[model samples]
Target: MMSLYLLNTKNTYTVAALMEIAKELGKEDWDFSQNPCDGNPNWVTPTGNLSQSKNVVICTCAHNDSCHVVNITLMRQDLTGVLPPSLAKLPSIKVINLAFNYLNGTIPNEWASTKLEFISLSGNRLSGSIPTFLSNITTLGYLSLENNLFSGKVPAELGQLKNLYLL
Candidate 1:
């Protein structure tokens, strides 16, 4: 398969290394970044730690509708560290592609409040029980937590997500 690169806004990494980051993130990051490249021109510059870029890859949505179109996909960037709870504040986010990475720790309980439609967080080192608050995120359609360190029984409250099509 061909590889894709997600450049740091500084554009420091070689395309080859960028492609490697995309691959480690699950190949989905490349796809999301590509969709908006045609018309909307979606781009994400690494804000912090180049070595752990995915952890800081925040979605900067435009205020006006004209520039508000973003697919918000960055699945396999090989991101590590705990997901920042601040991420739940992005109300404009639609799709969050964080599939393959070294992400660890608990899924933020505050994420239950976001307007996320698709959330992919498989293949990480996450632990602790799935947050019960996530059941309140009615907009979530696709949720993936496969291949993680999460233990205990799956919460029955998760079935509360009526709009959930995949889990």
Candidate 2:
């Protein structure tokens, strides 16, 4: 997907989206000067370290060297801020784990169309009824919404997720 990301530098917008997301999440030290898909510690947490799986941006590179983001894990960071709508801009993103943060606010409606399959917003300060639109993300399989301030019955639409095995 290099061609896709390099055509007029399309990745610039992706980086901008990441920056906006990082800013909203109160995340710092991300050096966007280097290619985020390069597996740099500034962008990806090195494997086998104490911080492994705690914070990272995992990407998949095509045979042509075009890289697309697929997973974002930001567990237990003590981060503060609301869930940013810019997250929906990562067209290839699928999994997101922002558990154990100080984030507040309900999920953004903009995410209803994303291809996300696994989402964990548990252990935060988020409130409001869970959006029924979550069922619209047909790819969703695992969801963790526990340990929050949310109220209301779990949407029956979620039962339509035939692939959903965990909640």
Candidate 3:
């Protein structure tokens, strides 16, 4: 016999993290209408819909019925303020593009542990040294820290990524 693991419950961490992200970005009305996977076909008790929400997208998990946030693209929204550290809670996130905005402050150190493959923070007003932890994300293939106020030398560890093609 084979063992199986399923996640029937909602991803509360991602929900809370999104709430914090909206609050931090000054878009308090972004969306909290319901759980991301509330009314999906896989759920035992489906209710509500995710399509009503704007500026948000989700990806369903394969081994489980639950959904996880995979991308957050708020490019050129004129958004201001710093990124909340809470965003790291979304373990499944892959792409985070907040480019062409007025956001400032340092990149949250908490993001160093994410499974991010693409990160585009270009055309912003962010200032500070790029966190060394970024080089630790082996999944990272594309990085765009250009057009910012980042100081210090690039981490040598980034060269270790075999999949990375863009910078």
Candidate 4:
């Protein structure tokens, strides 16, 4: 069996950033007693069930033996807050699935500086036109903005993402 000590603690900066993200998303369930890299219920749930109302934060410790959040899945949570700009503070985040929530507001401008790969914001009340800054996240591969109240034609700049397969 793996020892609990093998799990690395998230850097204080990362922890602070995650806490801000939770506050912005109205998520009060995050358990700070355990490190974000610990395989606990709040940190890592049983599955990626987007149909269920749950919050999951996942981190990776393989690189440099330090913990870094890699994925966050908070779906059907009925979260009544805006998309968090604090998400950009985690440099290792690759996938963020916040689908089926009651969240409003458009993606934050801070996200333009992220190295995200996949993002699913479907089934929300997000409004405002899709930002052209999305194209700035050159590493983005998949993006889902469906079922939102956003108006205006898709930005032409999004075509700049050569790795993007869906938008």
Q: Per-residue alpha-carbon lDDT of model 2 for 31-94, expressed as tens digits?
A: 7666778777877777788852377888887776666778988888888888878889999999
- The model with the greater lDDT, 1 or 4, is 4
lDDT digits (tens) for residues 1-167 of candidate 3: 21212233466566677777877766543435544444333221223543422244456666655678787766766788787677788888998888888888988988888898999899899888887788878899999999999999887888888878998
Give candidate 3 misplaced runs (Cα > 4 Å).
Answer: 1-8, 34-56, 61-64
Best by lDDT: 4
- Per-residue lDDT of candidate 4, residues 2-53 (tens digit): 1122233446778878788988988877777667677777676667645467
Query: How far is 164's C-alpha from truth in model 3 (Å)?
Result: 1.4
Ranking by lDDT: 4, 2, 3, 1
Estimated TM-score for each candidate? 0.61, 0.90, 0.77, 0.88
Please give the CA lDDT of all the candidate structures. Answer: 0.60, 0.84, 0.72, 0.85
Output the number of the TM-score-best candidate: 2
Which pairs clash (backbone N, Cα, C closer than 3 Å) in model 1? 25-76, 25-77, 26-76
Q: Model 1 — TM-score against the truth?
A: 0.61
Per-residue CA lDDT of candidate 1, range 1-167, in tens? 64343334433232343344344333333443342323322345444435433422333433332222224444556667566465454445567766777888888876777888888888889999988888888888999999999999888888988999998
What CA root-mean-square deviation does each model show from the true structure?
10.4, 3.9, 8.3, 4.5
Between prediction 1 and prediction 2, the one with superior lDDT is: 2
